[model samples]
Target: MFFYLITVLLGLYLGCVGMQLVYLVFIFSKTGQYHRERGSLPAGSAPAEPKPDFSAGVSVVVCARNELDNLRELIPLLLQQDYPDFEVIVVDDRSGDECYDFLLLEALRHERLRLVRVNETPQHITPKKFALTLGIKAARKAAILLTDADCRPVSNQWIREMARTMEGDKEIVLGFSPYQVKNGWLNFFIRYETFYTAVQYLS
Candidate 1:
């Protein structure tokens, strides 16, 4: 009986591993197919014209509970994006910290900055979700981009790069975000897991 149980468990484990390999291969094939299609246009067709610059207005929405320190770094990066038409909306979800006061000052300094204050959250919904909903609704533009307070863009061209993918009928675009590298086993594990999750979804 013990031998039979071990054999069954091993078989199940192998089956799960095989399924995971298959899924990864399938996702990778999709990426290859996309590139191939782009590379080989119809033989007789004229060269495709370059896509125009993304001029559509974009609104970046962020939800923060008590992330004032991180916000101080992230908001400046967001405001400095090189996009022509965009707005930054920060949602303060009843933070006990100095977030409300800081956002008030930022709004005054930058005409493109908007603030949404959330004093009460419903028992049925998460605070982040509730705050994001309010911020999105308050957005002046149709294209809404969501990010966290802790996230920092690597460059000012972040918005432009993201918007470039939204040309044509594309409704959604996902970008890669690896965790900041730190000198600890926990940080290493977290970064590895984040990369794995990004591969699983972004492919």
Candidate 2:
């Protein structure tokens, strides 16, 4: 009798777990469908282009803390952005790693690159947010673009697309970042999870 009771409880637990997984799958599918529909608008349906006026200034701010590996990979990409008139500001939030040193070296190599190191901690604030605020305050351009240290733009036209999209009192522009794919079942699961997240946000 006791063996039969234990078997029944185990089956019930398994059933609940299975049900939860099914619910999550259902939610993900719905979200992906919505994102696809919204993202598929025709190019001609976009807003009309604004009059040609030369806007030469832009500032790209990146916040980092103990991100040596990421800095090594992304700094060159930032410096190489095809934007004609822009500055790249890397705000180092008291990184204990060698990222600061790396930034110094890269700054010397790239005239457009600037480094801002915060040596002291804020009394009561998040370091990343504080660093970003400082970067914005110190920016020399009217337009400020924020990106993570690990991120890289897909092409030279990234800035062009972003700049052209801003017209007629548009305050915010939505952008999408694609994730790198890897091998195995875990990668498949992660991709599915990312798709689900994008769906929720886009919807």
Candidate 3:
């Protein structure tokens, strides 16, 4: 009886692992290709009605709470996105750091940058959610793009790529956010976990 139980448990574990391996190899590997071909029609298919152009205007929203350093580095990269008509809105959620001052200066210099200052959050409300709400409300564009202050876009055409995927009836578009590579074992583990989560969710 004991031997039979051990064998059954081992088989279950191995089956789960095998299924996960197959999924990673076959399905997860296609994520990049799907992103690349999202808006394209099939090779020989008849032309369908034209989809709406979502890239005409977009609002890039960032909710920050005491994230001055990350914002300082990230804001410049966001401002440099290749999209023609877009605005970057940063919500300062009662930050104790110099984030508010920095955003104020940047907003003055760049007409495309907008700042929403959150002085305080109610006791019952979450700060990040509140900040994001304010930022989205302040947005003047039809499309809202959300990114974290700590994240850096891998390409200047990030907005363009995302907007392209929204051409059809898709109301919500999910994106992948990979962590920066580092030399430590923990970093490697974190990156792997992040990639795995992206695989499961993005697929």
7-93 per-residue lDDT for model 3 (tens digits): 999999999999988987888777765644447668898766545475569999999988999998999999999888899999998
Worst 10 residues of 3 by lDDT: 32-41
Specify the highest-TM-score model's number.
1
lDDT value for candidate 1?
Answer: 0.89
Clashes of each: 0, 0, 0
lDDT of 2 by residue, 18-76 (tens): 98788667764554454432245566787445553238477889999999998888877
Measured against the true structure, the TM-scores of the candidates, in listed sequence, are 0.88, 0.70, 0.77
Question: Which residue segments of model 2 deviate by more than 4 Å?
Answer: 1-56
By summed lDDT, the worst window of 10 consecutive residues in model 2 runs over: 30-39
Can you list the residue pairs that collide in candidate 3?
Answer: none
lDDT, residue 24, model 1: 71
RMSD values for the candidates in order, in angstroms, are 3.2, 5.3, 4.5
Model 3 alpha-carbon miss at residue 104, Å: 0.8
TM-score of 3: 0.77
Give the candidate order by descending lDDT: 1, 3, 2
Better of 1 and 2 by TM-score: 1
Superposed model 3: Cα runs more than 4 Å off: 1-55
